[model samples]
Target: MERKVCAAAVQFNIELGEVEANLQKALAGIRRVREKDARLVVLPEMWSSGYAYKRLAALAEETPRVLEILKGLTAEKNMVTVGSLPEKVDGRIYNTAFVVDNGRIAGRYRKLHLFSTMGEDRFLAAGDAALVVSTSVGRLGVAICYDLRFPELFRKLALEGAEILCVPAEWPKPRQEHWRTLLRARAIENQLFVAAANCCGIQGKLDFFGMSLLISPRGEILAEGGETETELSALFNFEEMTSYRSQIRCYQDRRPEIYGTLP
Candidate 1:
């Protein structure tokens, strides 16, 4: 049996410290894709609150409010949604990604790799584990912006039976090439579909280039957005991925014993 699902990556401009306006913009982007029959929708990292680390304490929302919006939207539309935001829990902050399925909070992933260049290390506590959540859409793995640079995380998820990987990023304009290359590399190497949602517009002195992408298991660009506020979508077939994996057999040929000496 071939399982297939429609997925969308939403790209939008976020206002710094304006939670209400940012929420409205995110919801509007989701609504647009929902009309297109997207069963799984992904929003950019910090879509509700901008990535203004200096004002993180004041801008970050409690878990309740973020979940309420995500769960409500997913339940109302009967779809799955994934997005990252700044969460303040137990007097500590973490860049977390929440997976909402049919209005319920199915899973949460705190970003393990914090981007030091952006001062994420100073403002947020790093997550200790990788998150792979099982949902109606498929077995999905979640990663944040900087986490995409590490292939080991994606490989671990692949070994754990993840069929699709979703990444929400606030990737900047200067490193846009790295963003595109890394995404395609992850999909190709892991032999799974990769969907990345990135934000646009300027935040303080930094500018974000919105090139949200959906890449296939074979490293093909199925859908891609330009440097603007838009939504990119595509369909993923699990059966095709299965066939490719069987043919390649990359996972079966790993020499873990010899490569265990690193670090």
Candidate 2:
């Protein structure tokens, strides 16, 4: 049986190298989203670090600390939350994101495609496995930051029964068009709801594109934010994704059997 769920996307700014302040800001957004009766809240990538990609050594938190805190938020609000954070695991550093559901971690996905143009590969390690988790809302697929540019990732997730794709990003201003176009393509082609939460304002020298968007299966932007902080909430009907997929049969038309080494 399918359930009806409301999703909230929190678009906000963060303090560079200040986890305490960012968490306070993010916590306020969480409370606000809960007040609005949303069952899930989405936050931007590396939000706790203000997309301060340079300060991983100083601002990065232990993975356990992140999970311990988000557990309380999920339990108290009775909802799920997702966002990316810089991780320190077993002495290795990774740019990663977590999906918290029902008071515990549903799963975590690492940012596989590091943007070398931004020198991300210089500081962080790329992740190997794709994360797909089954939730009460639906099967959720997670991709952080640069992962949005890769359509094949969404295709694989769609093939795995993912009805909703959560993208937590720190996309800067210059590439706003790419962000919007790629996000919509992912939603329309995959026949899934795309909830993309991006940071607003400037983080160090880079300015973010604040068009945090929640889109429908038909590739329409149901809600979009401007160049400021906002918690954009919208209701999505999973039935639409299901109905479109059944009618169009996009998945069935795939010729994966003859294809090899798809990105």
- Top-scoring candidate (TM-score): 1
Once fitted onto the true fold, the runs of candidate 1 whose alpha carbons sit more than 4 angstroms away are: none
Off by over 4 Å in 2: none
Model 2 lDDT tens row, 153-199: 88888878787899998898789999999999999988889888998
Q: How much is 170 displaced in model 2, in angstroms? A: 0.4
How far off is residue 166 in model 1, in Å?
0.4
lDDT of 1 by residue, 7-81 (tens): 999999888888888888888888899999898998899877777777787777544686798788889998999
255: Cα error in model 2, Å: 2.0
Candidate 2 matches the true fold with a TM-score of 0.95
Superposed by TM-score, candidate 1 places the C-alpha of residue 121 at a distance from the truth, in angstroms, of 0.8
**Candidate 1 accuracy as lDDT:** 0.89
